[model samples]
Each structure stands twice: as C-alpha cells, then as structure tokens.
Target: MTSSAENSGQPVFTIIVLGASGDLAKKKTFPALFGLFLHGHISPKTRIIGYARTKMDRPDFLKRISQHIKNTTAPKVKTMLDQFLDQSTYVSGAYDQDSGFLALEQEIQRVEREAKIYDRLFYMALPPSVFIPVANGLKRNCYTTKGINRLIVEKPFGMDLESSRTLSKALGALYREDEIYRIDHYLGKEMVKNIMILRFSNQIFGSCWNKDHISNVQITFREKIGTEGRGGYFDEFGIMRDVMQNHLLQILTLIGMEAPRSSNAEDIRDAKVNVLRAIPEVIESEVLLGQYGKSEDGTMPSYLDDDTVPKGSKTATFAAAAFHINNPRWEGVPFVLKCGKALDQQKVEIRIQFKDMGNAIFHKDVAARNELVIRVQPQEAVYLKMTQKLPGLGMDTVMSELDLSYASRFTNLTVPDAYENLILDAIVGEQSNFVRTDELDEAWRIFTPVLHKIDRGLVPVEIYPYGSRGPKHLPEFVTRFGFERHAQNYSWPETSQTSVAQAVAALSADSKL
Candidate 1:
C-alpha cells in the first residue's frame, strides 16, 4: 500500500474530480486517469475520489467511468483497469453547500491518512455556473495545507471579456497563479505540443517562419456531427466561444510565438503572451459566421431543428475569421482560424502555406505553393506539400508530399489522450501547456467585440447544408485574406493505396534531374 511512497521517495498523489457523475467526467476525465495509471505515470498509491451531487454506489460509479476506456482482450489492460478502479471511490456532494463539502473533505482526509498522500488535484468538470461555488467550497472545506493543492479548471472560462476577467479575479483570490491550471485540452495534443520543436528546433523551418516567406496560416477544426441534443448549451456559446476562442487561438499562439528564452514553463508562456498581445480585436467584417441546416438529402437535422434550440436562434455552428498580428515577424500575413461542426469530415490541422515560388522555372499552374500541414487528429501527421516532376517521361510537374504520418512513422506507439497528458502536467506542476490569466484576458480581448456583435444581431449567420463543407462563401472568405487555393488536384499519399515508403521513394526518384 505504501510502495509508491517508498519507491519514489515522494508523497502519494490524490485526484478529486468534481462533477464526477457528468458526461465529461465519465468520457474524458476517468479514462485519462486510467491511461496515466496504465502508463505508470502516477504512483500506484494514488487515490481518485469522484464528488458530485448524484448519489451512486461505488460499483455503479466504477461502471459508468469504465465504459469509455478502451475495450481490449489483453489481460494486462484488464488487470490495470481493475487496479485503477480499486484506487478510485465516489462521494455524493452538493457543489455549493457546506455539508456536502465537509463530507468530501473527510473522505479525502481518510484516504490521505491511510495512503500517506500529501498532494491533491481538483478537476472541475461541472458547468461554468457552478465553477465559482465549487472553487469556494473546496478552498474553504477541502483545501490541503500540508502539501500541494492544485485546481484544474475547464473552459468556456467566461462568455466574454468582462465575464472572463470577473471569473479570473474570483479564482485568483482563492488560489495563487501557480496553483491554478486553466485547462485548454488542445495544448495537450501531440502535434500542438510538437509545434515549438517543429519551428525552433528545425533550421529550415525556423529560417522562413515569417511574413516574407509565409503567405498565410490556417488553423482549422472541423467536426462531422452537429450539437446533437446539446443545442441549448451550443446556442449560448456558439462556435466562436466553443471552438475558435480557446482551442484554435491556443494553436495560433504556438504557431506564431517566437522562441522562448529557455524551456522553462513561464518563459514559454511569456512568448505566447507576446503573440496574443500583438493580435488586435477581431473586426466583424473579417469574420464569417454560419449555422448548419439539414443535409442535402434532408436526413440530417439542422442546428435549429433540435427541440432544445430556440425557434429563431442564430447561433453559429461554423465560424471563420481572419486575424493579423501587428508584430514585425507577421505584420501583413493573415492567420485564419476556421472551425465548424457538421462539416464534410472530422479534422483539426494547422496549415501553413508558404509564399508562391518566385522567379520559378515552372509555369504558375504547374507548381503549388509549399504547404506545411500538421493534421492533429483522426490520424496525426505532419506533411509538406511540395512540387515534383511527374514520374513519367513528361516534364509536367505534380504536387507531392514529404510526409510524416504518425501511423506510418510511429507504428508501435500509441498517443496518449490530450487530457491524460495535461492532467499529468498539472500533477507535476508544469504550466507551459496551460493558459495563464493574462493569456486568457488577451484571448478574450481579440474575440469579445465580434462576439458581442453576433450576440446583438449585428452580424449575419449564413446557413449551409449540415454534411457540406460550410457556408458557400467559405472559399471566397479565405481567398479574401490572400490565401490562394490551387486549382490542381493534390492528395496526401499516405491515404492512398500506395504505402508511405513507396510514395516517398517515388518522390525521391522524381526529384532527380
């Protein structure tokens, strides 16, 4: 029982998950904990306590969380899961009331005493309405003084700039800046984490990461499904708040930030903050908003079709905006952030389109500009779309890729869930990947004006078929920002019937003079 403390010479770690009975907890939080335990990132003595208002027995609670964990026939997975469940227990509690918090505190104390645990992490998976109350309750009733106490908060941090600052002010009073982890799960993504390394560590990329060589940068998040039954929640925040504001903007900072002085977390965040400060507030004219309608065949439902949605709701399920950083490095280049639910496919990617080859030997139509694409999910990949001669005897040029598809390259490794990586970072006190207070404030500043406009019916919401790409003007909108879409057809070789090795070899052969 004390082996974790004995082996590591460190105190046991405990994670107290608020809103444990909620969907986010069961689907993401617990499964992530199981991942960390399976990977041996946490001490075996680690204790997981789930607190929520719903009353459920230990067995029932275990059943709910375990449902989303990977289903495997492997005995090791099963054993690890059983052990994870063994270390976890549930407590019923009201978020705001003192009585429920007192019960939660007692249970936590019992675990700490039994396991000799000293550290605690509270993950808030509840609605934003309950965030303040739960934070206050934990601070008053459950905060541990003997060891580290960390709080992990999820977002829609607030509806807008004023609200975000208000929430930050309240939380700051309760917890020191270092003790709070504002979770923006996108920061935990494999590719997003790789952005810094990809830019600074590589000379070829580092040399040209500027307005002079790069035409435009696009950070896109697309979902194949709509809000489903969560229209009420979706309507309030809309796509601007839900996806573009936090997740996509976080990606932009990583892409646009200068190299940090050192690898220290604060230095890295300082670099990101500088990027945020350079970005001006979004202009409503530069933004295109859209809400999904029924699919072409009328089989799929629209955003307003959900009974939970208001009849005249104009909440945008799709948003595309052009942002310009006024810094010397990226003065004129547009950083376009596009996000939509109920689109053609599910993909999250950062597409950096380099300036068209100038004074080139090839005809304009023959060569497409080099594009460095980082596909973040469904199949993680970082591929460069470059020009090459067709493999045949002809001089015709073709677009090919220098691809590093994770599936093809890292065949044996399984990428950890975003939550798992972030939760582990919180336990170890790493803040580089988490958003800071000032970073949150700056992010809100960029989006608040446009958000307010949309809320007040000043901006129009275009409607597109649910299964289609997005608003019909999406192509034109992106084009307006100087993002050129090549007319020639190009596809990622890794997705085709040809193997990655074969595709790379063919490209190598074609490149020969």
Candidate 2:
C-alpha cells in the first residue's frame, strides 16, 4: 500500500524543546514526547533536541526526563526510553542572540544530514518575555525551507487585547498563521475534545443546547495547592490572566459555540470566534475577585505570606465573573467562569443549569433545577440531574443523575495527557486543538476592561481561607447568575483525593498493558 517515493518523501521530524531545563519541559514536555515514543507515534529517525540557558550534561538531562517518564521498568518501554534518550541531545543558549541559535541550527543540521527535506517543530516552553526574540532567532537561523516548519507556543498569550494583538503581529511577521500552533492545551483534554462530539453527535444535547433550555452555564477551575514557590510568577498574572483568559475562555468558546461547518480546523475556529465576538465586555459589578488567606487547618500560608509576593499585594488568587453572549443561541444566558488557587478541592467542570419547571403538580417536591454537568478532570464524567419519582410508593419526587463516569464505564480507558495529544496533533499538522490568532484577540477583548478595573483598584479583592471553597461570597456570586444548587446536598463520590489517585493509577496500569 506504500510507494518508495512517498516513503522517501516522508518528512524527517526534528523536535526542539525550548526551555528544556525548565520545570515544564521536565514535567510535561519531555514526558509527553516519551509517551508518544512508547506508543509508537514518534518515528525512530526523529531527533529530539533540548535548548535552554542552563548548562547541563547528557546524564543530568536524562535523569531529569526519566523522573517524568512512566513504565521505564517494562522491557519494551526500557528499550524505547534508551532509544529516546539516545536521540535526545541538549543545547545551551541565550534566546535573543544569533550566535547561540546558529550553534543550535548546526546541531539540527548535523542530525538531519542526508535528508532532502527537514521538518522542524519548535516547542516554545518558555515565558512570554522571550517569545518574540526566540521566534526571531529561530526564523533567521533554524527554520527549514524544504519541508513543513511548525512553531508550537504555550500561553498566557498576553495580559489583554492590546498585548495579545502585539504578540500576534510580532509572530505574524516571521511565520504564516498555519505554521504557528498557539496551544491552549485544554482543547486537547479528553472530555474537552469530547464536548464537540457530545454536542454535535448526540441528538439529545444538540436539540436543547440553547438559551431556552439552559438558564446559565458555569465553568470552574479549582486548585487545592497554593503557589508553592511560583508566587512571583502567579502575582504577575493573577488568576484571571493565568487561567480565565486562556484556559477557561477556550473551554467556554467550545461549550458555547455553534456546530461548525465541518471538522476542519478553521471551520471549528470560525464557529468559536462567532460566539466570542457576540460576547459583550465583562462588567465590573458582575465580577468578583479574591485573595486567599491562611488555610482553615492553620498549616498553610496565605497568598501574601509568600516571601516573593509584596506584603501589601492585592493580587487575586481567585476570580469569578459572568459573561452574557448576545447571540441567538446563548442570548441572556449567563456563562460564569470561575477559577482559583489554594482551594478546598481540585477539579474543573462545566455545569449547565436548566430552567425550573413551571406549575408542576408536585411543585413543592420538585424544587431541584435540572442540570447537566461535565467534569473535565480528576475523574472525568457527565451527568444530568433530573427529577425522578421516589422508588418507594410515596408520591414524592427526588433528584438523581443519569451518569457516565469514564473510570467505571470504560475499564480499558487510556486518557492521554493534554500535552501529549496536542503534541501529536502538532506533529500530524492538525490545528483544530490549537488556538487561532483571532480567538486569542477576541478572548482578551471580552475581559480587558474588567482586568483594567481590577488593576486600578476599582474591584475589591475579598479574602477567603486557603483551604476553603473560595470566597464567602461565592454562593452569592453564582446565585446572581441564576445558578441554583439543589436544596439537598449531593456529594460526588469520586471527587475525593483517594478516589482520584485510584482512578489515575487504574488508567496508568491500563496504559502499560
């Protein structure tokens, strides 16, 4: 089924991991590449290069990467790791200068010897400060003219609309939009990727996914751990820029957008952009910001307590805001995006609360509003809470869920890391999961004014216990958007820490087998 010319023309992939000595490279980037290698997605001839300012020998690099790679004990996996490490080489360099880039390019060309075409995939794992400089250097020095050249960038794209547009212009000067992959790794998530399928493929969800059936939608991102040692970085961006602008907003677009013309990248992105453009600017009154205080257990420190944070810093560790889309599908429907650090729990989910039934025969008994919840992490699931008659003979109604828990239902499930999926997508020239330039610009447009207000002291940052469920006003904040919690307490069994670990371990075991 294969021709010799076609086989010979297969691009020789060269992956250069920028900021290779950084935590992201060790914890996520290298691990993801290794995962692809183990799964036979990466070709044997592919050359993996690591570039960073930190000077480290090959052994040290291998050890750092090995900590994140799983199943190294398995015979086949051991061979793969050995080969992967063998293929991996380190390059120490400054981002701005041409000399370093020239040296790096020399190394790449050496490995790519004899190949007529060189496919270069540069993964920018560094911060925004050096993004432009690095791109300039790569374009002038290392970019291949023969084959496909893809640049994969990580986010915190920019602080707001102006900054995002500026970054886009800078990158646009060096590369074509299709050659640049701006990753919002959330789009690579299993359930997040499933949202389109869940909405478009399923007749049940597609029929009622509008303002009439949905009262309000809430997208929440919670983190249990505080900024351990990254307070300096966290303070610079705060929760809104760090999470909401890129991660949460991307998820919101996917959830709120109309069905695409087709599954093509640009078509899906066009649909998302239409919904984003319809959203008016986020208002000051509708926004709630907060900084975390000490934990209730008294063992944890407050956000300001971190040595790196200024003593009187007003940086918000938590933020909750509501956006109203002016389009036909989501008109008047509030989409609340909430995110926080140092919270009581760690989870991300989207909750779509439907309007309450009017004048029901058992109105008093059926006080619970119908809700469709899609859990994004820590045990992925989707459940709809609907009023059901009590199992007993009594004429009473109770709320229950029609649930699909990934762990329980799909015993053979092997959910890939978000980065792994995105990396593979990048290698295969798929842009659907990556962010488009206009999408980033539109996202910043919706929140720029609110961000300015927060920066200008117009929005007061409330204080909540580090280990508590966020600010005391969280309930009031959600209620204002018409999000109703069932009167009775409903505890999700799999939300606990132990259960999450078990599910993850189960998935890991399945992946190895």
Candidate 3:
C-alpha cells in the first residue's frame, strides 16, 4: 500500500465526485465511499466534495446520496454515515465551463486551508459526452499542484477502435497515464481477483493450465432483466460493447495470461497485454448475435416494445463469440465469451473444462471430465467438479464437486463491493486492478471489426425470447468451440450432508446395508 504521506507528502486527502447528482453517483460512487469510511480506510483529515450542474442544497444532496446505502438498525453505522456525510459537501458546477471549475477550485482551496487537505482524487460519473470538456475543465482550473491529482474515469471509453484511441489521446494529453485510473469494476471483483492466486499459488492448477490439459474455457455473464425503459442507452452499445469487449475480455486475459515476474502493477498489466495481443480480431463467422423479443407468456414486452428504443432497432441484447490466442501455451484452446440481458438467470462465471481421461480405468460414460468453475457473482465461489467411486458394492462412479462457496465458508466476512475495492486502489496508487492505455488499445482492437459489422447491419441478429437462455443456436455455438456439456446429471449439494455423504446414505438405504 502506498501511504499518502510517504508518496505525496500530503497530510490530508480530498475526493471530488463529478456529476454528483447523477444515478451513478447516488447508487455506486457514494455507497462505495461510505463503505471505505465505515471500514476506517478513510482518514480523519480526508474531505469529500460533490460537483454537478444541478443546483441543490447540501442537505438534499446528502439525502439523495445516502438513500441507496445499505440500511442498518445499528446506531454505530448511522453515526459513521453521519460523519462521512458531514465531511462531504456539494458544489454545483457546469461540466464544460471554466467558471464552474474555477469556483470548484476556490472551494477546494478553502477546504484545504481549513483542513490542510492536499491530495485530490476526482471521480467522473458523468456521461462520455462531457468527459473531454470536464477533463479539460479540471486540468485548467481545478488541478492541484501541491499534491497528488488522480482521476478515475468510467467506461464505454468510446464506440470503437478509432474513437477509443481519440478519447485516450485526449485524456493522455491532460493527465499522465500514471495519474489516471481507467475503472473497470469487473477487475476488482472478488473471484476475478482470485484468478491469479488460484492459478499461480496452487501447483495443481498451474501445471494443467495450458492447451495440453485444458480443453476449453467459458466466461459468461447473464442479466435476468431487460432494458426496462433504458433502451436508448442500451441500443447504442449493445451487448458486445457493453459487456464482452470490456468486462468479459478482462476476465479472459486474467485466465490466459502468463505469470508475471512480480506482483508489480506494470508487470501484471504487461502480462495481460501480451495475452490480448495474441488474440486475433473476432471474425464474423465465429460470432452469434441475438436480440430479445417478448417472453413466452404475453406478460412481458420485447426490446422493440420499449418506448425509448428506436423502431426496428437491430441492436443485439445477447452475444456469444469464440476467441483463440495464437501463443504456445494457449494455442488452439478456445476461449468462449457469452453475455446477455433478459436471460433466464443472472450469473457471471468462468468455467475451465479439462481434457477427458481417454481409455482410462473408468469408462468415459461413467466418469465425467474435470472442470474448474469460478463463480464471480450472486454467490462467489471456486469449485472443481471431479469424479469419484460410488460408496457401494457396485463398481460405479459419481460426479461431485470440491467446493469453496464464499457465503457458506466465510460467514463473518463481507466482501467489499467492486467500486469500493477500486476506489481504495486509486487512493493508494495501485494500478494493477485498473486498465492501462495499451491494454485498452488492444482490447478495442480485438472487437472493433465485429462491432463495426454489427453497427452497419452487416451481421444478422437472431431473435430470442426475453426470458430464454439466449439464441436457440447457443448450444451449437459453444460446442463448435470445443466446449463439452456433461452427460451425467449433477448438482452441487446444498444440503446438510456433503455430496459423498449423501450418496453413501442413498446407497445404504437402497441396499439395506
């Protein structure tokens, strides 16, 4: 951890949230700050200022920001929230103008004079339209010369390769790469963070994490709800830009990258960039796109039914694409990425299926292939599906899981939200969990061609029911990329008895042993 005083020689820290009146600020940004404050990660000398064009009083602003914070009946939580809000004040300002920023600078200077605050961190929760102007405004009028000035920007960096480069170039001119944090909240996820540790630290996984042993890798993200009237924004990006190109691709890099020389941020990011460079741009033939229609029942509306959506919009609500890296370690091994909104279930997981034991002691029909599954959300977990001998007289095999479900195992610990983790990383100058310039460039390169094809309506969009899993061809799409579905039925045991124990009991009852 980089100490504020040691790195910046500053005794106090101030965080200024741009677009403070927006939904992102109210729901995620403020809640995350409150989490840091509640956990005592924030310093007593630290101050917070909210900046936006909406002219509202401090009390109303406070009320709006705190409304989404997780409720607790405990008095201590309430007290801490009050203290956090007390340190936080609102400053209404236009995003594109120097006058508003100049006023913001004066307010910051006033707080600094009173509290001796020097280090400043700006969080941009505004739209991409205002990003450049706001960035320029900050640099021109609100920047601090005496201490560290860090800027955290959110994603949809740009529409495609060219636009992303343009945005990157503009931001690079304003702030040095080291001073900017490109926030990809997915990188801060608990299970995603565990990928390197699980592979590098464990010899069992490290030895087999290659093309020789691993057959296929699947990374999937599914959302159960539709646009729900937010189709205007959803139509512009579609599922590929919104999820696969950034979040799912980041997860894939972590899974496919070589072990870094050290835990340094540059080393880790360099390894990730190498992995990204090895991946060829997505081919149109290898991609499947789908837009959601109404549910099977008439109760639900289709994507086209949304009032905000354009008539006959060809935007894809779901996508499944196969990616392969042209490197020695991962050569020919398929990395399948799938993401969709208005699916049957909400899940984010990485599943690595190992090679089958060909002509081994057990028949292939009885013994299933080994698989390492990492569930990133809903209930964080790392479990490996393995085959074991049935606890009975018969020479049969059963499949079960070696599980590490976070909720069941770590009862007392609360996993910090993704935003909380990334924000703290920014405060301490940690860059490994944040995206880099070249990294962003490579990511955009991999998907830009496909994105353009979709944008130009060159690719056909398949229609799937809103509540269905995805397009009807999804099974064949994954199978084409070497993913194999387990033939035998299996489910992780959620009962009191372990899987083996339950199997044993069932056998004993059947045989009267």
Candidate 4:
C-alpha cells in the first residue's frame, strides 16, 4: 500500500473498537482505519484491536471488511495492502459485564506486548445507551498505564436538550472532556472542512462575510429513499432530531461563525460552541413538521404501514425549521434548515443568498443577488454566481457561476469518506475532527423547543405523498418570511403552467367522451 513511516507524529500504540462486528464498524469504521494503514499513514507497530460481544475469530473479522475496502480504494492502495491488514486483530470482549472487559484489556496488553507500543484508543461503535457503561468499564479495567486512552463515540447524543445534559454529565464523570472524542462524521466531510478555509483564507470573502452582506441561509439534506426496512428507527427519531439537530446545526455554525481566535482545536471548537449556544429560543410559528403518505400507485408503504414501525406513529419523516443566531452578525438573517427521508432526491447543499445591491441607476431591473452554494455530497464543490454585463448590443447582464468541483479540479486528490477521515484523526491524535460536550448540548438546545412543540401538538403533522418534495405549502412557508425559491424579487418565467393547463384540458376532453 503506502508508506508506514510517512506520518511524523502518529500515536505510538494499539487501538480498540467496541462492538467491532456492528454495522458501523463493519461498513465504515474498519474500512476507514484500514485506509490509514494502507496509505502508510500510521505508525508501523499500530495494532487495531476489535472487541465485540459476538464470538468470531480473527479471520471472520478480517473477512467482514474486505468488501468495504475494495469498494473505497485509493489509487495508491495496491502496493502495501497486506502490511496494513497484518496490524488488525479481533476478540470477543464484554457486552455487559466485567470479565469480558478484562479479556479485552488483556488483548490490548498482548497487542502492545507483541508489537511493543503504548498508546491505546478505545472506540465505541455500539448504541448510545451502551456508551457510558463501555467507557466506564474501559476506564476501570481496560486502560493501560502506558499512554493515552482516548474514547470515540457516535451520535444522537441524546433525545433532546435535557437528555443531552444528562448524557454529558454521565460521560464527564468517566473521562475528561479532552479525552472524549464525540465523532460527527459530517465534521470530516471535505467541503465542510474547507468552509473555514474558504472563509478565512480568502481576502475578498472575509471582508463581506457578515450580516450586512448576507440575507438568509437555506440548508437542505434531502433523501429520496424511503425507510426501506429501517422504519423502526426512522419513526422513533424523525428527520428533525436525526439530521437537523446535530448535522445541520454544525454546518450552520461553521458558515455563520466568526473566524476562530486561531486554528487550534480549542479555539475553533470554542467558537462553534459559542455560536450554537446563541441560537435564539425556538417558537412554534417558525417550525414545520411533516410525514410521507402512501404513494400514488399504492406500491410504496407509508411510514406507519411499514412492518417494522408501530401503527399511528407521530414521528415526523420530514421537517423544516427556522433558527436565528442572536449575535449581531446574524441577527435578522433566518437560518432555515430542513431534512427528510423518502421525499425528493438525495441532495445536501448550503445556499447563502447575499443581500441585493441597491439602485445603481444604470439598470433598474438588475438587482439580482449573488449566491454561494456549497455541495457536500455526491459531488464536492463550491459555486459563486455573480451578475455581470453580457457581451451583447443591448447592454444586458447575465448571471454566471464560478465553480470549483473536487473531481474536476484536483488531480491526485482523493477526499476520503468522512468515516475514514475521522478514524485517521483518532490515529493521528487530532481531536478537531470530533464534537465536544458543550457543542452537543448547544446542538440540542437549538431544536428542543421545536421538539417540544411537535410533542405537544403545537405544530401540526403535515403529510404529503411518499415520493415527492416534502409538504405542499412548504414553498409558501418560506415565502412568508420575505424570502422566495430563487431570491427576493428575482422572478423567473414559469415553465410548469403549460403542462398543468394541458393536463386539465385533456382531463376535460376525456370527461366529455
């Protein structure tokens, strides 16, 4: 594969994965760590210790991750592949007791004894409820006295604001804040990582990146796939808590916050936490919740009708909510975040609409605002569209976009999947790729009122067809806030009216027959 000693300061130790046989580990966590090994990006003696409740041999564990690796291969991954794989070992450790944890501890000790390394990283791939017990057991029985015993845990930190605090208190008792790395893979996305660089490194951008220059921010993380066989989980958490609460809020904080005092983890993380804490208290009028109904052909199952979900489930499959940062820089600018399952297409994008330029006498109809769109998935790119004079006799101006797409612009540039990046961060001892407890609490704070509103029936559950773009009046809701589909007062001629009229006229003709 790659060169093992290429990295200058990798942690000199063994690493462990709790629930190593789980879906996240089998599909994502292992593949990501293996990517680091294949690239020669880790210390030569690093041993990955996989501990799970399931009884499996080392070969079985190794067999589980082969398909995921080939599916996400880097161009330089072919040469040193075996060397990377040689570092991985598997063991069936504790699920809910101390004896199993002792074996896991001994395994880590044996790995260090065999390979002669010290640093230990304990990663939990189990559900959130098991996180506290696993961390406590690891701290009490598993951690070696030699080096760092860092913990990495996955998301949905809590159901709401109150639970988030409770979970944080629980975690704080076992591990120091710095020792706990609450991973949000979205924080590892290439474009999301680039957002800070795009804002601070560019001179022109830094000057106008404020409330005075921007109007509103619209974020959408849409998925075309329905629950499939996951209706049980989808119905319980809903789209709001699943996506908008943590992932979307993190993005908004990145785009809206001021330059951190410095680029260090503490400075950047502090800025994010501060901004998230400032999200104005939510109200009922500013939120919209919805669920997908049965499809027209009656072929697709509705959310409740899915065999896995309980009947008459009230959890929202779709959600649109408004949040405002009380800070002066983003006072009046509405931060609209919406996400859903089984409606529209799979798209994750951030649209920043700049304020319209005031009267420039030379052109009365040329007040079209500029927009900066950051594409986060399927394609990673940054686009800024500005209005300029066209090369024509009429002195007309046309809007043109400046684009920077990762696939097209970067040769030899392979942005690793978020999971891969996060896993690498842990190996390299970088906590910037993770979320802190304060950030988690602030994330829940922004949406807790909205969650309460949905719970108390203050916000109605709007329903729409299974395979459509969310609620029918969704566009109207945004329009009421002095915002529109494109931008304020920038009208485009209609293209859908002819089709609607033709359908109506044809229906009339059919009825007459």
Candidate 3's TM-score reads 0.95
Instruction: Tell me the spans in candidate 2 whose CA falls farther than 4 Å from its real position.
Output: 1-11, 114-117, 364-367, 495-513
Q: Total clashing residue pairs per candidate?
A: 0, 0, 0, 4
Per residue, candidate 4 scores C-alpha lDDT tens digits across 251-365 of: 9989888888988888998888889878876777888888888876787767877888888777888888788888988888888888988786777989888876776664534
Instruction: Name model 1 segments beyond 4 Å from true.
Output: 1-11, 494-513
Residue-level error in angstroms, candidate 4, position 126: 1.2
lDDT of 1 at 192: 92
Q: Rank the candidates by TM-score, best first.
A: 1, 3, 2, 4
Candidate 1, residues 1-513, lDDT tens digits: the string is 233334465446789999999999999999999998888888788999999999999999999989999964579999999999998999998888999999999999999888878778999998899999999999999997777889999998999999999999999999999999999999999989999999999999999999999999999999999998999888889999999999999999999999999999999999999999999999999999999999999999999899989998988999999999999999999999999999999999999999988888877778788999999987899999988888998888888889888877775688888999999999878899999999999999999998999999999999999999999999999999988877888777546324756877888999994
TM-score of each: 0.95, 0.94, 0.95, 0.89
Model 3 lDDT, residue 499, Cα: 51
Which is better, 2 or 4, measured by TM-score? 2
**Cα lDDT over the full model 4:** 0.79
Q: What are the lDDT scores of the predictions, listed in order?
A: 0.91, 0.88, 0.91, 0.79
Instruction: Give the winner by lDDT.
Output: 1
Task: Note each model's CA RMSD in angstroms.
Answer: 3.7, 4.3, 4.0, 9.0
- Give the least accurate 10-residue stretch of model 1, judged by summed lDDT: 1-10
- Model 2, CA-based lDDT: 0.88
Evaluate residue 47 in candidate 3 and report its C-alpha lDDT on the 0 to 100 scale: 86
